[model samples]
Target chain A: MTMTFDQPKTRTENQTRTGATVEFRGLQRSFGNVRALAGLNLTVGRGELVALLGPSGCGKTTALRVVAGFEQPDAGEVLVDGQDITRVPAHRRDAGMVFQSYSLFPHLSALDNVAFGLRMRGVGRAERRARAGELLDLVGLPDQADRYPHQLSGGQQQRIALARALALRPRVLLLDEPLSALDARVRLSLRDEIRRLQQELGITTLFVTHDQEEALSLADRVAVMNAGRLEQCAPPAQLYARPATAFVAEFVGVMSRIPARADGATVHVLGRTLPIDGDPAHGDVDVLLRPESIEVVAAADGSAQVLGAAFLGAITRLSVRSAAGTTVKVDVPSPAATTLPVGSHVELALPDRPVLVAPRKEQARA
Target chain B: MARLAMAVTALRGRIRWSRGVVLLIAGTYFLLPMVCSVVFSIDVPGQGVTFDAYTGILGADGFLDSLTLTLELAAATVVSVLLLLVPALITVRLTAPRLRWVIEVVCSLPLVVPAIALVAGIGTVLRWGPDHLADTPLYDTFIAIQDPDFPVVLVLAYTLMALPLAYRTLDGGLAAIDLKVLVEAARACGANWPRAVLQVVLPNLRGALLNTAFLTLALVLGEYTVAAILGYRPFAVWIVGIGGSQAEMSVAVSVIGLLVTWVLLLALATAGRPRSARTKTTAETS
Candidate 1:
């Protein structure tokens, strides 16, 4: 998707097809005893914004660093525009990166910081400054050009950092938790701004973030990683609904695991027999269900009692305990949730969607 | 209530008085020796307060040569020490951070080894080099380093002596800013490692670099034991050597040397401050 913002027409015209495809083929890295990337193979299409989402120490940042050439994979190759750049030094890679910390050169003003790459490339002083000024305007901080990094607010520093990263018109933009240092309001706004700029520039970007909402909202695809491996790589809605593994289901969104007995193609969960989503698990298993998928009805003789209710704007999450001692969370419309207060008994029902099941042992560990 | 208020006021006044007394004592303690030195340098037996000792400083034999040699040694020491430590410290910080303690221990080793002992070891090596390397081409290296015109061995010794201070100041500067992030950012901006260190790292470490240079300059200017023991008549040794025949001249030169060191330190301090900070200071002062 290409977007045209209020930026100077000439500059936008110059960036028409700037993005390059990035592919990580069997990338493997290890730090002493701990493996960071275990034979990781993934590809980001041209102009795609793929977010590497995982918990801390899960190697999301390591994978992004490998692509940016800050790190060399132990055994695999990283290709940009189908050219292997696995051994290229970071300076020659032409991959622009925004760091989690405030990486703006504190000694330089915002304009100079943005123009640093142009200067390194031997661009003339006047042209570099003019281009930097335009980039500052793009990030909505044109007036802050003369201000040093220490003088600007944290959010403004990040905006300049973003402009600086974009100044090179790099093949791929690597965002390593760029908004993680900002507060919630700034993070939300910058997240949108990054997405808008990425779309406008059509730059292929690999954003590493542990924030599930940020990944789901901004990414064309979210690659969920766990323990040095990609759990699942899919679109936001698909990854949310049809998570390939139990780890992906739990990591991507809120999921509740309840004991179930699977036989053949169906699983009997919460007094309802439903078709299994993936490979059928026989005998005892745990079924994973989204809170919104399970419907709760206020019933006097229901087997489950509403343990607690959390008002979440449009929907209220009700934590209910069953007679069989399994706690399940169900999301109901706030207005209806008022009728099912804590201590009130409710009957739960599932729609016709196939439910994913994991072995009971894994559920116990989770 | 009035009595209690009076008591508190009296207590505050007593504290202020004590602070004043402490300041006066410290000021006298530091200033009295310098004041006596200046007085002794100027006072003559019959001419009352003659300025001849100060005036004769420029025309004194071996004065300018020794001072120039000391400055050259200082410049070479500063360059050698910074060149050696900056890259080593940065590399240690960036890659093998766990080996940081190793650098620290090595740098700090010079501080514990007495100057006399260090000089003894160097003397032994210098003496041994001539005998062992007499037949080899290295025989000239021993003679070349011992050149009284500009002893390179002194620069080597000064570099070793300045390591601990240089390491601390640079390490402190590195700690104040995130070195890894800055270098990575510079690299991402298309700056190679050398460019990154030269432009980004060094600029941010301006204060620390100046401080390290000043300390090294001071050590070279004031050092007497190593140069004296090694039979080199640098500025400090010359000042001490003339004490028997020209006591007032020696004291005058010492006083002038102290003043020069202070001026250089002040100049460096002013230069090291950020332009914005200097402007702010000027505005506040004005």
Candidate 2:
């Protein structure tokens, strides 16, 4: 679905282009013996929003911090607008960052907090306040200008934080898990709001989040990291449909691993042979299948019995165990799920699309 | 039923009878001596209820000098200790957190050392400095710190004595707020380290700073052992010295000093409250 917002009118007229291209070249950071970023390289195009999606301790936040100039990379150079700022101090860098924690200055009123950067830049009081007021209105919190951060709700505080980050008109907006601290409903709404604002302002942004859904929904491209390395960087549809690595396939979405035997370019699973998606492997292998990709039908003499069913709004996920003791989860419409009760026999089938297969040992490691 | 009724009544005031009784006893214990002191200061033996003792405090010998010296020492101690501890604590918290325990131990070491021992050690150092460095340039430095007008030595001692209290207060404040996040946010907003600390960190720590200052001030004002043993006449020592000559006047001065300390505490508390809280308080009252 396409969502749109009016262009921000308060953006200064002189600032014709609001976004700047950011490049990370061989960025490496280490905390004692632990390597947070190892020779990482990625470039964000002007007006592009790239979400760094990874599990906890996967170095997504570390990468974001390195770009914000908070953490010094052991060996890399970060360039914004083609200018190297690796050695620049955090305050000197023009990267506006919104942290995961409640980062609004508790002592300042909302308006003053949003105007802080302009104040640091020596902007006149009247101008900064007017700009701050406009930004507050953009965030839909104009009436909350006089309130302190403690007086605002969590979602409101984050909205103010977003306004504060944008107040400086920074070249690149860095969000380090900004929505992770909020509740689920707020998270979804703020996720859309952030995407809308980013699009409206046309600011190049680096959003780091552990949630794949958030990444896929909001980012132009999602960079999946695993163990301090970029496993894959692609558009959400491509990343989901054609994951470059086993880690990416498993991490980006839920994948059911069914033991299969591979011969050359095809693998046999569930009494059917399928073409291998990526690398051709022989011998014992595990084929990964998305829950929705498997077609499930109730049959009186089916080989599998339904173990459990979990209702998830429109779709219900059913856990089924084959006669061979292999358990696979399948997603079917809630109406069809009602017909397949627990202990009922079912049949599963895969489509003609190539299936991702990983060696049993490699799948275990991933 | 009677006990239950009394307990419920006490609970409505947010103080149980047991707590109320304990507070009443403690108040009496602390206030009885001050009441007697006031009575003694006002009631002359043969003359009825004279105000001469209270009024004569300003005219008393060495009163103004001692008071001035005490205030200076208190101010200097507050500044020096905050200067020494604030940045150190913040740096340790932000950069080298593992070393926080070492600083805590060092700051708290003064508490274990007795005042007499500390003064004796200072006296030994003072006597040793002149004897060993008589011909050296350092001899003059030793004499300057011991100057009676504003003894830098006493200020140093009081700063050491105030370290534990100041560290705990500042540490508690730092703990309550996410110091790293706040500083990073300020830095992202284009504030340099000094500006971030001065404008963001210090304002947030206003309560802790005021509390540390008050504790140091009270400590400096009431300290007699170190100053007296070191042969300095700060207010506390002056009060003791006057007690030998005029008992009623000395008691009156002590009462007034206590009252002044309470007033200063109240002022600091009101000043340290967050602006929003203060505004709300004013609004509520209105």
Candidate 3:
């Protein structure tokens, strides 16, 4: 049997296919007293996959649903390929949506479920069946087409749901937490498979998720949202390195808040002066430093004492308490951290580059 | 190990005692009446037990006519109840969900209004309708509604009476499936409102439809109050009318009617098993 997981040419071929640009302009939606989407503006380029990442109740789902035509924004316009489609019904918008639940029609066989959209479009029986078969094969489930939904595993059912959504050849694909229900291992594999299929189709896609690793690993760009507003929208590396707000910095990865003295374009922390990115306030502020950025050295006269250490394959994370009674975590190579055990004294140093610093009042528990 | 097994056996005995007691009580409560009916139907005080009373009804006059009419009314009741409830339930659930309690109350109104009181109200309307509508075109409709071949009034009354049962069954089935999501999914696939309801929603509710239909069938088959009061000789009324003359045969007929109803209910319960489960069983057997 030939393996189909490694093919790469489909991404480019899909780029030339019918990938439409989707734009959300000044969208606002509210439910009772809670605002779901507050003047949201976002643009997804042709054939681009952008992940809308946020915690639950962050309105990331509401924004995605607005694009799918399942929800209407109270005061904004949604444009597909520069044409206003705010008033269009969901089915007529040419947007394929895969829900969080499997959402398969329990009455239909897997093949029939995949072919449902085509049937709705009035396609001929034989033609819809043939196309559905091809889609089943693409999702690596050709032999299970005759099985009912209950007979299939959860992963298999989701694959059929994906095929059903794609059977219509929609202009935009909307996936709302599609992998959140699966087991961890299945979630990883299926997410990669979905990403591969999406790239292959080259469809402009909006993927809503609460998983940071999933968003970082799968999307061409990630839009981090909070309280019905987009906090930062950038590529994964840029989002991680230079978050626009303190919320994004805390949400994206592990970072320790260290008290620091801030001046114009510079912050003093750990007895070292470091240039600060963006605007640096001239007062006491919180400096956010990644664990890897804090260099740890073993010394008898060290100011910090190692509290605990955890060996994580290639790297070891050390928790140390400094002389100022502030606890900070540091990461080093396993071989390097092996020498620094609990109760050992260590000194902490800072990186020379510019770091992200925010006003002290903005520092809240993530 | 012996002590552990003994403890498990004691627990099992306790569970079996509770289950067996409940089963025995239920069996006696329900079965004893049917057993008495069978014995009363077959036993002749002066003669040995025989099925002469059971066979006696085959040759009785008006037996076939009443049975045929009741079956037709049951069929009409099923069709009318489904047409009225399914569309209304779907529309209220998918669109104005705030009106759900109102719809539920309306569907169950027949249950609160006793059958005798409801029949009295309908009787007044039927009697006063022609006089009030005199000289108007609607006067003829009142006369036409009392057609003997197929009494529209009887069918109407039965439909209203069957509403609560049908509504509860359909609503339960709808609750089992995500109705809004299914409809939206279908609409997202290019189906219109009616097509989505017919194609996607209805197929998923096959079990509910069958249950409602059977419940209505059993109801209309045995209902005598409205039909007898309206001066229409439906099967139940005919059985009562014959009981005044031939008591044994009528009792036998009642036993037969009970058997037929039991068969229908058994079939309905079995048929309500999901198609996927049925296919799995078939495949295993094959």
User: Candidate 1: which docking quality band?
Assistant: medium
Candidate 3 versus the native: TM-score? 0.90
Tens digit of per-residue lDDT, candidate 3, span B1-286: 9999999999999999999999999999999998988898888798979899988788899999999999999999999999999998888888788898998999999999999998999999999999989999999888888988789999999999999999999999888998987887777677777888888889899999999999899899889999999999989999999999988889899989988888988888888887777787553454
Candidates' lDDT values, in order?
0.90, 0.90, 0.87
> What DockQ do the predictions score, one after another?
0.60, 0.71, 0.58
TM, chain A, every candidate: 0.94, 0.94, 0.92
Cα lDDT of candidate 3 equals 0.87
Over B177-262, each residue of candidate 1 has an lDDT whose tens digit, in order, gives: 98999999999999999999999999998999999999999999999999999999899999999998999999999999989988
lDDT of 1 by residue, A212-246 (tens): 99999999999999988888899999999899887
**lDDT for A287 (candidate 2):** 86
Best by lDDT: 1
TM-scores of all predicted structures: 0.94, 0.94, 0.90
- lDDT tens digits by residue: candidate 2, A1-366: 122223445445445657899998988888999988888889899999999999898899999998887899889888999999988999988889999999998888889999999999888898899888888888888788888888789999999999999888888999999998999999999899898888887899999999999999999999999878888999999999999988998898888778889999999988998999878899998888899999988999998889999999999999888655667889999998989999999888899889999767433311
- Quote the lDDT for B26 in model 3: 100
Question: Per-residue lDDT tens digits of candidate 3, residues A138-224?
Answer: 888988887888899999988988888887778898898999999999999899888888887788999999999999999999999
